[model samples]
Target: MQIEMKNIHKRFGANNVLTGVDFELLPGEVHALMGENGAGKSTLMNILTGLHQHDEGVIKINGEERSFSSPKQAEEGGIAFIHQELNIWPDMTVLENLFIGRERRNAFGLLKTKEMKELAREQFEKLSVLIPLEKEAGLCSVGQQQMIEIAKALMTNAEVIIMDEPTAALTEREISTLFEVIRSLSKQGVSIVYISHRMEEIFTICDRITVMRDGKTVDTKRIKETNFNEVVRKMVGRELEDRFPARNPSPGETVLEVRDFTRKGAFENISFSVKEGEIVGISGLMGAGRTEVMRAIFGLDSIDRGELYIHDQKTVIHTPNEAVRKGIGFITEDRKDEGLILDFSIRENIALPSVKSFAPKGLIDEKNEQQFVDMLIKRLTIKTESAETSAKNLSGGNQQKVVLAKWIGIGPKVLILDEPTRGVDVGAKREIYSLMNELTDRGMAIIMVSSELPEVLGMSDRILVFHEGKISGELTKEEATQEKIMTFAAGGQ
Candidate 1:
């Protein structure tokens, strides 16, 4: 079966999320959608899945126009979508979740629990997904839960399966397993819609690729015809000036030093140091305690015992405010929950961290506040109509930039960024890379935590591999090979 969407147009209020976007998914082919955040990839998928109605479009399944008013209609048409945020009942067992809506009834008209369990196990095996059949869905790793969601799509025998950012939280081994499963599905004549930000995975799995920008179709091309640089150019519509700038550390003794930092059960024995104007990247699995170490550094979490020295001065940081005063800044993974107040305007959010800095005679200086916010936004290239716009209305990438702007406004010497580009699109990623290089060049000691291997490899001056919250080994940029990083990250100790 072939799925074709022609002239897809969708709008919300004054913003057109998808405009005249045309796409297609051939039978047994993995078609990938590439775009910046807010480019409407998810919107188009939603329309195909009948979760949202399109203003104008012709959807053809096997050359016949089809209309879907709800997910049931789409499912009946052999289309299944697994969103980035999995839609599953965490409290329910896997068997119950698999047969919730399509329950088997007994001959006497009662529930058929035995049949559901048998069917769920069959589905898991068929999809090569490892999930406890009777366990609660909430008690699963991010990758396992993702696999379960994909398995559910398979249980329906979907002709077209759409996956959005399927490997965002998956480990390297899990990603390999998923890629194999996708290939098997393609071999078995299932068309796949793969949406992801990782370019390496795109090249590894996708046969055809389509790039979208600003809700408009860029072009669709064969995988062999496109390159990473070309795809990045199309994503941002401009060349990035520089990604990693020269690292010239002032080296005024040791600015910060960690001695045998340990977080039991999560990670242990982490020891490292960062001088002024140095950027250190921690590379590892999603739970490698890189973020946890940063949390402990910023005094967000309690550490059993660890020595922290800032500017050659021993310090005990038990609160974020103390960390802030000690010239340390932390950017969280979930920008919405920990970074910014979505309801507030960008100006207000940036001022929230160090609003007192702009105070004159104990009264907040409105002019200075605006000046501080404006400087960060301009430097960060935050895409917004105005600073007055609510941060919630911005794109995911832009929202991340706002978070950066909020923290950068404080002028911290030791800045920590955790998964800074997690849910961001390619274009904004380029911009973030640009800002990081520029900021580091201007003498800001930095610590970056990233799950993406390429990013850590490309941007870090030195790479520290973490295994269960401990530093397995440290590698300089010249020595930080992806394979080496992976080895140390996967229990190299």
Candidate 2:
């Protein structure tokens, strides 16, 4: 399959998304789409896949001009799109979710359950997935869910597959397996359109790359012909200084501590302490209990047996409200579902935690609220027209910033961040790191749970590795390295 998009123009009211963009894909080649969060990468792909119509453009497939009316039409034309957000039905079984819309049936219209199982098993075996067909889809971990989405796309036997942020939720081992699968598919004459913000993966797996910046195609070059710095410079339209900011630690007394924390089947014997003016990083593979521990600490889940201490005093928190009142702020991993209300304005989401502070006498104070929200917006460098803009209207990086701003408004002594930089662009990531440094300088302790090793090493004062629900190893900032952390994470001494 060969696809060519030329002189594409898209507009939504007054906002122009894609302007005069050109992209091409050849059979049996992996093409990369690189850009910042709102650079129109996804928008261009959406136009190609028929999710949105381009106001002006020409689409040609195999030298024949074509325009698809819907995603189903595009799929029927041998194109499949695996979105960044997994579209899984939680209540349905794994098999059911996989073959939801395109189920096989007999001549009498009877469901072919046996045939579907065999087909699904074939795809799962090819990908080295061990999920049960009868298991509920919601029971799967995020990494497992990612694998499920990949397998679903492969089952379609698509000639051209568009994968957006496919590795964002996967672990190192899972990513290796996925790369192997992609290589095999390419060898079988399948073309792939890979979209990701991770420069390493883009250079490693893609044969050719297309860079987009601010609704325009900046350049397209062979992967071997370009370097990381050049690619980033093209994406952001400027020279980026550093991937991470400098951290100068000034440790104070312990602000939060947990002893013998045990959650059966989740994590066990988790003992750690975070001090004021410090950053403690938790590193582990997916499903290794990194996120479970944080959830329990924030009172979102139950702990069978544990002890929590705040400022050298025994504390008991049974709910999130109590945890907030106790001076602990939590930034959840799923920002769309748990962190913010999508339909609400940015001001509403930012002011949610500290609403009572502005309304002391059971009446709202609009002036004080506006000033407070406006300050954080400017401080975080969130790119929005105004605080009145809906959170869903902003890009992924800006939404993550709003989540951070919401937590900062509460003024918690200890803030817990889970995957703070996941799916964020390089430029926004540096800004978030700078903000983290500023917070620590102001005597706020942070406990960050991250899957990315470089981030853990770059921002942490101390590191703790988790393996099978236990603290496998602990290392100081000077002692930590990628090899040592991976060894601990893999349960080696």
- Highest lDDT: give the candidate number: 2
lDDT per residue, candidate 2, 1-493, as tens digits? 9999999999988889898999999999999998888888888888888999999989999999998899989888889999887889888999999999999999999999999999999999998899999999998987888899999999888999999999989999999999999999999999999998888899899999999988999999999999989998998888887888888999899999999999999999999999999999999888899999988988999999999999999998888998999999999887877999999999999999999999999998999999999999999988887899999888888899999999999999999999998888888888889999999999999999998899999999999999999999999999999999999999998
Per-residue CA lDDT of model 1 for 228-258, tens digit only, reads 8888788778774544444444444467898
**Candidate 1 stretches greater than 4 Å from native:** 71-73, 85-141, 239-252, 343-345, 358-368
Worst 10 residues of 2 by lDDT: 236-245
List candidate 2 stretches off by more than 4 Å. none
Candidate 1 all-Cα RMSD: 3.2
Question: In order, what lDDT does every prediction score?
Answer: 0.84, 0.93
Instruction: lDDT for model 1, please.
Output: 0.84
